[model samples]
Target chain A: MTDLLPPIQTTARDDAVLKALAGFVRQEALGPGEKLPTERILAERLKVSRNTVREALTRWEGLGLVERRQGSGTYLKAAVSPDMLHMPLTLAGGNDFAGLMATLEIRRALEAEAAALCAIRAGKAELAEIERKLDLMEEAFQTRDGMSSEEDWEFHQAVFRASGNPLFEQIIAAMYEMFHRFWEHPLGVRDFGHASFPYHRTIFNCIAAHDPEGARAEALKLIATVEDDLKRGAANLKLSDRR
Target chain B: MTDLLPPIQTTARDDAVLKALAGFVRQEALGPGEKLPTERILAERLKVSRNTVREALTRWEGLGLVERRQGSGTYLKAAVSPDMLHMPLTLAGGNDFAGLMATLEIRRALEAEAAALCAIRAGKAELAEIERKLDLMEEAFQTRDGMSSEEDWEFHQAVFRASGNPLFEQIIAAMYEMFHRFWEHPLGVRDFGHASFPYHRTIFNCIAAHDPEGARAEALKLIATVEDDLKRGAANLKLSDRR
Candidate 1:
């Protein structure tokens, strides 16, 4: 039972400090705009170093949990409640087929919207960058037996950025990294279908043509194909492992 | 000129080490399956403490950049290129009107998809949790002149979780946190319209009925209202500042 519980003290001292401070705030019933104790005081109360407390506060500031005013003191920026304390700000990095499928669903939503937005909003520089990434992907396909997943990833990232929404780029990049953790082969390998490769160019053309609906349709079709391919790949990998 | 460059040496020693190691990988043109040098050697080369090196490697493992086999050495799981090193996995935390609007665009994409998925995949328990969150929001609305943004946030979080897609929940949570950093008032204030408050029940009813299309349509309509209200709020805030 003890092993089942996570060790409160570990190398992740900053994370531990974050939890401790959150607990302290909750116990005190601190509300928004309420000033928190000094870093030194928090360190002493938590029996940790001042640097650790500072690091935790800095992270909290980034998460909008607290605000540090110059010389005024740190204050709560939002209400700290029991449920909010444990809300993860990133993916839990699950390594399973279902996790992969769920991530793809998110990608489908993001990618389709991104393509439409890019069609309407991509600037000349952004469009040029997209074209450059596409050129690189084409080169890789021509020269290699298998498409370069890295190049393919870069192409999609370019499209996401062209959407002019940084959140889309950030979230999709994180998903790409998380998928790499458990996938045995490159993610592109699972992207089956001979027509899938050319769809990249078609999607690009829609964006360049400034056809938002066309771009959205093409992106949706592409992801739907990738989803079918992923199902097939999962089954094949399962059979091979069993053999 | 010196001030223009970010200090390579800072309290974020682990991040510096990450950059150093990524540079080393690129210089060596290391590909997947290539083994990295021992920690001691890497620490010596980078002139950092062994602990820093270990922390960097642990972070890299989490990012799926490297894999450490038990009793063996760390190996590159994917190609480390110039662009991959600079790619940010989180938002840059822009504090401006355009940034807020951009984030809302992402929310629209994720929220619509999540509501649709929740309608199809949410279990009885998840549906009960969603209803419970709605009850809390309704109670808050009944007692307060202004809606509680926190309650509203919790309600949306429950819906995201009910989607059975952790990515949707994680990404949306990050965006919510990012927006809070700069917004002067509660986010829910921008959620205008009498119909808007009632839309929550409509959304919940759609999900409860297991009507994915209805849920998706309602979610999109709600976000569209929020977006328009946001534009109006921005104009009002600008006018007030001028006054």
Candidate 2:
């Protein structure tokens, strides 16, 4: 069995560089879009190697915290504390059974909001993308069960994008990525979310019809089906353990 | 003016290490709590120095993606795609005016959900913590304005913790960190959420009363007040530009 590990550690070198960068930005009172000092200058001042600075900046770029211009210097994309840039969104429960339930609860809220927003805001391009993803999901599920299907994931992602809120898309995409990474093996579920599969079309139709309340109701129903599947999967796991 | 930078770059070395770690985890089919190869082993196998592997692991630890025991090897804390491990929750709009508005919109949904859940799930300890934070916020605001007050921030964070969902706390904390970093200077706001201040006590009362619907409604009201502040802030910025 894995040992119970304490959740504390000395700061990593790259992390120290990030912390130094935050200090520098705050000391200089740099606002969004303001150019940061060059990598060489930052490294010299912060007493870290240029590669460390570059790597930290690159990671910040990925997080939408900074922008590195080709000819110009790197600029602050967002005004965030050092701590905010380091850790991605995740549950303390990790990938345990409890974590999955917590994720479902969070998704229940987010998906409902996304569907409602999509219904009111999705444009022609977003609608087309959603429909295309739904078609892909349907075709994929026709050949096989919907367990861990990439198309099913893509359909949900498209719906989030249709919500016209990039934060929802980012947050949900991360959660789904984490969920898909573990859902099949540990749960021993072969055909999860199949019950919720038909709701995709109804949700799409509601959005297409510009009915926010209808879309939200359908999304919640879809989540409820997934929750039921999750409970049943857990029960089956328990039964198999006894056997 | 800051240069318009393209959001594309070659992967950094540490990022390469993280990607390789993900590949390693997948190839080995490491599940949650499964032991990872030692840093020395991973460095040798992945053709990197031990320092790089250690740094990557430390970052993963911060993201709650891995846990490092003292004597035992590092264990996978969560089954997450590598992409999810790297970027914290953030808006694509960054820290600009648009980003603030987008953040407020996301918070509207999250805060209401959090408040409702806090009412249903918060334990006595959590409730006490919430009360403590609210008292601190009240005390801090009595001495001065509430703009960018740490106490005010802590109060909201405590409420999020009471929601019993770590993801909500994580996501909202990141948003507020990013928001607080820029809200004062660019917007020229000396005070914020003052209009929403009294609502905190009311919301706390609802949570204390175990009133989920009331908590949710008051949370929405708090966000609505902030939204009005944002609109007024923008209009004031325009007026100042003319000056």
Which candidate achieves the best DockQ against the true structure?
2
Considering the true interface contacts (CA pairs under 8 Å between chains A and B), give the fraction that model 1 also has.
Answer: 0.24
Clashes per candidate (backbone, < 3 Å):
0, 0
For the second chain, the TM-scores of the candidates in order are 0.63, 0.68
| Residue lDDT tens for model 1, B1-243 | 113464454376777787788788889888899998988888998899886687677656644567977679889976664334222233332445676787889888889889999999988999999999999988887787445567777889999998988778766765676556534463344444433567788999999999998998999898887787777767766745420
Q: Could you give the CAPRI-style class of model 1?
A: incorrect
lDDT of model 1 at residue B148?
55
Clashing pairs in 1: none
List the candidate 2 regions with Cα displacement exceeding 4 Å: A1-87, A143-148, A186-191, A239-243, B1-93, B145-148, B189-191, B239-243
Per-residue lDDT over A1-243 for candidate 2, one digit per residue giving the tens place of the 0 to 100 score: 225486776767777888788877778888899998998998998888887776677657656688888778898877766434233664543545667787787888889889999999999999999999998889888877564368888898999888978778877766765677665564665667778989999999999999998998999899999888888878877755421
Residue range A1-243, candidate 1, lDDT tens digits:
011212246767877876666666677777889998888777766677786677667656645567887678999976654334222233332455676787889889999899999999998899999999999998987786444556877899999988988668766775676555534353344445444678899999999999998998899888887787777777766745421
Docking class of 2: incorrect
Q: For all the predictions, what are the DockQ values?
A: 0.13, 0.19
For each of the candidates, the C-alpha root-mean-square deviation to the true structure, in angstroms, is 15.1, 11.5
Q: Could you give candidate 2's per-residue lDDT for residues B134-198 as a string of tens digits? A: 98889877866564357877888999888887778877776766667655454765565678899
